[model samples]
Target: MKKPLQKSKIPSNKVFVIKELREAYLDKYWHSHEEYQLNVILKGRGTRYIGDHMKPFKEGDLVLTGPNLPHVWRCDNAYFDPESRLETHDIVIYFPESFLGKDSLQKDEFEEIRKLLARADRGLEIKGHTNKVVIKMMKELVHRQGGASIIGLLEILNVLAHSTELEPITQIDYKNNYTAHEKDKISEILEYVLHNFKNKITLKEVAELANMSESAFSRYFKARVNKSFSDFLGDVRISNARKLLQDEDLNISQVCYESGFPTISNFNKQFKDRIGKTPMAYKKDVIDSL
Candidate 1:
């Protein structure tokens, strides 16, 4: 899809920019930029969108996005409440391909970094120990200046290059091919669904939102997203259900209703189908992992 290519705003005198951001809510716009980005969410929980991939992101989530990969980190609805005190904190670094110098990365010694950057084209979520190390370096980076900051970035990249804990956020074959008009239509549809998925959503409602007939919208969405509308809606509901299930205070029945499923039987069956586990089992896993 056609995304806004924002300039990284790396100063004319600087090799890169390392900054700390605190926002009422993370930017929810769907867009892309020409510079590579490394981000660590210091405080937030939300749905992360990387190209075609959709997943929940939480505090300490570390991700690297290569140039031109459309993405967004949308905060949960609670953060948007008018009287809410919720805000997000992040450490973000943005740089261009030339940060490694014109010919430096071409050398065999820099092969790993080059490959890492290439892999980042699909967006990477740094996990486990690698995330910890990179995040540590990133925190220290904001305090460094001049030569020190540049060196700090290189060291972080080096650690990332050799790390085996990177997870690809999107599929390898995924590509953006929609025009601005179509992208706008799909974005609006998703925005509506995302905001209102807690309640029942019908095909006619979303189809009308996209200004298309029910059948037309179904075909268009399936062709571009590679999933049927009902499947996508189920995925959205399941995602929210997964989040709700993590809270011990919420029972399965509550999770089912809160996530928009009409019945516990349907919720359990669909949850198992998509998550490969029952809600109770998944909740147990979350507790164990903690």
Candidate 2:
């Protein structure tokens, strides 16, 4: 995700903001807000970074993020199509945890809701049948006001609270304490790595991009992303390899080289470690499923 260039502050009285992003602009560096956020991606596809987890995003994807969890939604170039005049319609609902009502928090009926929010510190992706229902409810919430908004939000949470297929975006311990400046630095670093992961990346090169000493960069990178620089690089390469493996034309060896692995053995180990399967097995599974 691209860094947030500016910070947005919502007043305590304001419950949430509905933003329609139609331009090719970076939302801002990762930062947390006082209120929880429920984001529905109405259109467009790109990458989403919530806390320390980064993954591709697509239309109709709904995510709920807890308060103070850093997140970013970077839309693709097509999302800013001037000819279509279609802006990325994102429905964002922000509310303090207190909005759930004091009594509701104490009741067993809302236990799932509380658990869902607590788990949201790592972020949660709504999927399957729950996603369909929640997306529809969010669409309705967009046109509603006041009491309707509250009811709509509760309904959405209720659905999530009962969802068995909800996927967490990151580990429970993922830290998201990013100052605005640190967030910008980290985004630049990530962008540089993504663009160059197909080739060898040196510590000096990355440190230069951040304009920091190698040691300083190492500490800062680990602190911001919750992984070492090399681990982060390898993860990016493996993610791309997973995408390339879907193409039958690319054999295991081809994938290893194309994804910038230094050797076939190393690639196999990393792929299995990250994806929980050997490259050959993964390819076979993909083919068999197809």
Please provide TM-scores, in order, for all candidate models, with all chains considered together.
0.92, 0.78
| RMSD of each candidate relative to the true structure | 2.4, 4.0
Each prediction's whole-model lDDT (CA): 0.86, 0.76
Worst 10 residues of 1 by lDDT: 1-10
lDDT of 1 by residue, 1-290 (tens): 64443445588777898889998898776667778999999998888877877878889999999987877788888988858989999999999888867878889988999999999999999999998899999999999998888889989999999999999988777886666566567667776887899898999999988888999999998876667999989988888888787798888899999899999899999999999999989999988887
lDDT of 2 by residue, 83-115 (tens): 655456677777777775556665887788889
For candidate 1, list the clashing residue pairs, or say none.
Answer: none
Model 1 CA deviation exceeding 4 Å by range: 1-13
The number of clashing residue pairs in model 2 is: 4
